[model samples]
Target: MKNNRFLSILFICLLLAVGVSAQNTVKTSVPDTIIIPVVPDSDTIGIARVRNELAAAKLNEANMRMEIELLKYQADAADSLKQAKQMQRIDSLRALTPGVPVVVTGDTLFYLYAKRGGYTPQQRAQMDADAIEELGKRFNLNPDSVYIESTDIVTDIMYGNKVIVSFTDQDGLWANCSRDQLAAKERQVIVQKLKELKEEHSAWQLGKRILYFILVLAGQYLLFWLTSWLYRKLKVRIQKLKDTKLKPISIQNYQLLDTQKQVNLLIFLANIGRYVVMLLQLLITVPLLFSIFPQTKDLAYTIFSYIWNPVKSIFWGIVEYIPNLFTIIIIYYAVKYLVKGLRYLATEIDSGHLKITGFYPDWALPTFHIFRFLLYAFMIAMIYPYLPGADSDIFKGISVFVGLIVSLGSSTVIGNIMAGLVITYMRPFKLGDRIKLNDTTGNVIEKTALVTRIKTPKNELVTIPNSFIMSSHTVNYSSSARTYGLIIHTEVSIGYDVPWRKVHQLLIDSALATEGVSADPEPFVLETSLQDWYPVYQINAYIKEADKLTQIHSDLLQNIQDKFAEADVEIMSPHYMAMRDGNESTIPKEDIKPQTTGTGSTKPA
Candidate 1:
C-alpha cells in the first residue's frame, strides 16, 4: 500500500512540472506564420512570411517598442483619409515585420516616411497646424502651459498632460533629425503661434491698445492746435521783422531790395513756416497714431521709414561728404581770390593806371569777364565730382538734359556774346562816343556783353544787339573831332551877271561874321558849280564843337544874307524870266532909287 501511494505522488508531480514547462514554452515561442485579413492575399502571404521570420528571430523589447511608436506616429501624422488608409496599410506591414528599421530625418521635425503616409510634406504641415489649433480650442489651454517630453523611444508634445502631438525615431529619420530634437522644435513653434493668438484676442491687451489709440488721437489734436498757434506767432514775428528791423536792404545809394520785395519775402517765409509746422504735425501724428495699436505697429514703422529713411540717408550723406565739401570750399575760395586779383588788374588797366603793350584799355573789362567765366566753368568742372550725388545716375541724367537744352537754346546768345567780344577787341567805338551805325546816329550810352545802348540827339534810347552792330557799318564822328575840328558847309546861288571877285569877297566877309567859326583856321568860299543862269557858291567853316554845327550853319547863312543885302547886290537865287523895259532892271523897283538928274527934274513924273 505505501509503495502505491508514493508512485501516485511522483506521477502527479511529473504531470504538474510538464504543465508548467508547456505554459512557459507557449509564452516564449513565436509563430512561424501570420495571417492578415485587411491586406490582399498575395501581399498578405509575403508580408506574413517576412513577419513570421522576424518573430522567430525574436527582436529585443526596446526595438519592438520603437516599432510600435513609429507606427503610431505615422497614423497620427496622416493629413487625409487616403493618407490614413495608407498609414494603416504601412502600419499593418510594419506590424507584420516588427523588427524592421525605420528612418526619420529633418532639421526641426522628422518625417516618418518620404511621402508622409501618402500625404505631401505641405499637407502634413497643414494638418499639424490644424491639429494644434484643435488642441488649443479643445483644452482652452494657454500656449505657455504646452510642453514637450522626450525619451529614448518616443517624444510627446503635451498641453497639460494631454498629448497634442508626438514624434518617434521614424519621424526623426524622415526629417534627418533626432526624435527628441524634432518634437522640442515642434513644441516651440506651436507654443509661439498659440501665444500670439491668445495675446491678440486677450481683452486686456485689446483694451490697452484702445487706450493708447485714444491717447494718440488726443495728442494729435493737441499737436495740431499747438502748431497752429506757433505758426500764427511766427507769422506775426515775421511781419514785424519785415516792417521794422528787416526793411528793404540798401547798399550805399543803391537799393538792393525794395520794400515790395522785402514784404513778399517775409510773407513767403511766413507761409513756409506755416507749411512746415503743418508738415511736422502730420509727420508726428501719423507715426504715433499707427504705433498705438499692435496690428498697426509694423505699419507705423513703414510709414516712418518713408520720411525718416531719406532724412537719415541725407544726414549720413552730409557726414560722409564733409571731406568733399572742404575740397569744394578750398577750390571755390582759391578761384575767387584768383578772380579777384585778375579783376583788380583789369580795373587798373581799364582806368589807365596800368598799361600793357599789346592790350587796349577798352578790352580790359570784357577780357576779365571772359576769363572769370572760363575760370568759374573750370572750377565747376573740377568740383562736380565732389558734389553729393554727383556720381549718381539721376544727377548725370539731369546734367545731360541741361547740357542739351543749353546747347540748343544758346546759339544766338553765343553769337551775340562772340560779337560783343569782337567789338570790344576791335575798339570800333567807346562809351559816350558820337557814332552813326546803319541809319541811326547817336551817342553810345552803354556797352554790354550782348547789346549796346545809345541815346540819340532826340533823347530816344535805342538798344542794338552786338551781333547787329558787328554786321553793320559804324562811323565814329567824335573819334578825331578833338584833334581836327568838324567842318560845316552851306551853299548859295548867285546871278551870273554878278562879278566873281565881289561874290568871293562877300562870301568871305559873311563867313568871318558867323559865330563859332574858328577865325584862326579862317572861313573860305568856292565856286562849286556854274548853272545855266547862276553860279553855286559854297561857304565852308570849321567849328571846334561838333554839337554846335547846326547853330553855326544857321548863323553863317544869316550873316551871308545880311551882307549880300547890305551890299545891294542882286541875289538871284532862282532864274528870272522877265520882259524888261529900258528903265526896268532885275533889282527891286523900290530899292532902286531914281537917278537925280542935273536939272533936278522928276524923271518918272
Candidate 2:
C-alpha cells in the first residue's frame, strides 16, 4: 500500500513539471512590421512615422490572420488524423493483448489515471507510425526526420477553438526523452531487479520450507509415540509393582478398586506428560515455521505473544523449584487411598461387626463424604496453577464459556446436584433402608454425590438423581425403628349380593392368617364404600418384621382370595360386568342404598 502511494505522488509531480515547462516554452509568431520599435531616431517615437508603421502593421496583421487561419485548418486536419490513427492503434492493441492498457492523448482524467505501461509491440509500432504521419501533415516536417518522442493533445484557445498536437525527439539530437518514457524505463529496470532477486532466493527458501515442515511433522509424531510408550511402560511397571507387593492395596472388599488405583495413577501421570510434550513441541515448531517463512512473521509472532505470558510463568516456576508440582500428584493419590480406607471402615460398621458404642450414627456418613470432598478439593487447588492450560487466557475464557454452557444446558443437572446436597444434610434415608421416591419403592443400595441407586423388591436396580428424591415426597420406612411397625393394607370390592357382615369377617380372618402379621395389633376390616353394584372393604394388618412386608402382602392377598372362593362371594373389579334384567334378578333396594350414619352415610349391604 505504501509503495503504491509513493508511485502515485511521483507520477503527479512529473506531470505538473511537464505542464509548467510547456507553458514557459510556448512560441508566438510576429511579422517584420510589428517587430520594429515605436520610437524614431529622436529616442522617442514620431507620431507620423508610428502612424505609418501602424497602418503597415495592420496590413501585415491581416495577412498574418490569413496564415493563422490556414495553420488552424491544418492543425484541425492533423488532430482529426491523429485521433483516427489513435483509434486504429487502440483497436490493434486490444486485438493483440485483449485486456492490456493503452493510454491515448485527450483521454478523460479517469482513463489517464488508470493507464499503465508495458504496451504490446504492435501498439507501440502503430502509435509511432500514426504520430509520424500527423507531424508531417501539420508541421511540414519530413516523416523520416521526425522521430516522435511522445505526443500530447491540448485545447488551443488562441487559434479559434481546436486541439493542438505536440511532439519531441527520442534522442538528445533534436530533443530529450519525455517524462513518461523516463518513468517507464525506471519501472522496467526495478521490475527486472526484483525478478532476479526472487529467483536468486527461491531454492534456499524452498529447501528451508520443506525441512521445517518435515521437522514439525516428525516432532509431533515423536511426541505422540513417546507419550504412548510412557503410558504402556507405566502400566506394565505398575502391574509388576503390584505383583511384588511394592504397592499395597489399602482399600479392602471394594469390588470396584481391585488394583485399579495404580492404573488410575499411571493414567493421570501420562495425561500430564502428554500435555507437557505438546507444549514443548509447539514451542519448537512455531519459531521454526516463522524463520523459514518470513512472510508469516507477524502471524507467528502474534501467536507467540498470546501464549507467552501463561507458558512463561509456568515454565519459570517449574525451573525455580517452586515446590515440585508432582508432589501435589503424590498427595492427591495418598488422600484418595485414605478416603477409600475410611469408607471401608464405614462399610465394616454397616456389617454389624465393627460397632462403636455411643457414636452418633447419622453424623458419620455425611461427615465422611464432606471430609473426602474437602481433601480432594485442596489437592486440586494445589495442582491447578501448575497445569499448562490453567494459566492461559484461552483456558480462562473457556472456563467461563463452559460455565455459561453448564448454566444454560444443565439446569436440571445442577438442580440434581443441589438436591443431592440437600438430601445428604436432610438425612431422609441411607444405604440399606427401604424407601419410596418418585413412585419407585426399593431398598437404598448406594448414595453418591450426584445420584442415589436402589434395589427394587424384584431385584432390579434403579438409579435416581438425589435432587429428584429431595424435591419429591420420599417415604423412608427404615428411618425410624418400627414403633407401631409397618401396616400392609389392601382394598377390595364385593358384589352387593354378598352380605356386608360376611365380607368383613372374611377379610379379618384372611389378614390374621397371613404370615408376619403382628399378634398384638390384631387384624381389622372396615366397610369403606357402598356403590350401585358393589360394596368396598379395606383390610389392614400390622407386621413387626417390616423387612418382610413384600412376603406378608402376597400372603394376605392369597388368603383373601381363598376365603372369598370358599364363601362363593364374587369380587367386583373395575372390569366386572353388571347383570342385565333378563340375565339376573335386580338388586334389592336396601342392598343398593347406603346405611344411615350420624349425619353421614355408612357402607350398606
| Clash statistics: count for each candidate | 14, 1
Q: Which window of 10 residues has the lowest lDDT sum in candidate 2?
A: 106-115
**Model number with the top TM-score:** 1
Model 2, stretches more than 4 Å misplaced? Answer: 1-319, 322-363, 385-411, 432-434, 454-462, 477-483, 493-503, 531-535, 544-551, 565-605
For candidate 1, write residues 1-605 as lDDT tens digits: 35645765576566557656754664465431244556666987887778766654564443466557555644544433444465566666654543212211111332334333466545655565556655534325578788888876678888776766667666765444677888877677777766765655567777888898898788878877887788678767766766577766799999999766886787788778777877888898888889766557779899999999999999998999899999999999999999999999999999999999999898899899999999999999999999878989999999999999999999999999999999998988899887889999888999999999998878899999999998899987666556686667888888876798899889889888988778877878888998877889998877776555556788888788777766667667666643356655555545434555689875531
Global lDDT of each model? Answer: 0.74, 0.63
Flag clash pairs in model 2.
39-45
lDDT digits (tens) for residues 446-500 of candidate 2: 9877899999899989998877677689887765336567777899998877788
Give each model a TM-score: 0.63, 0.38
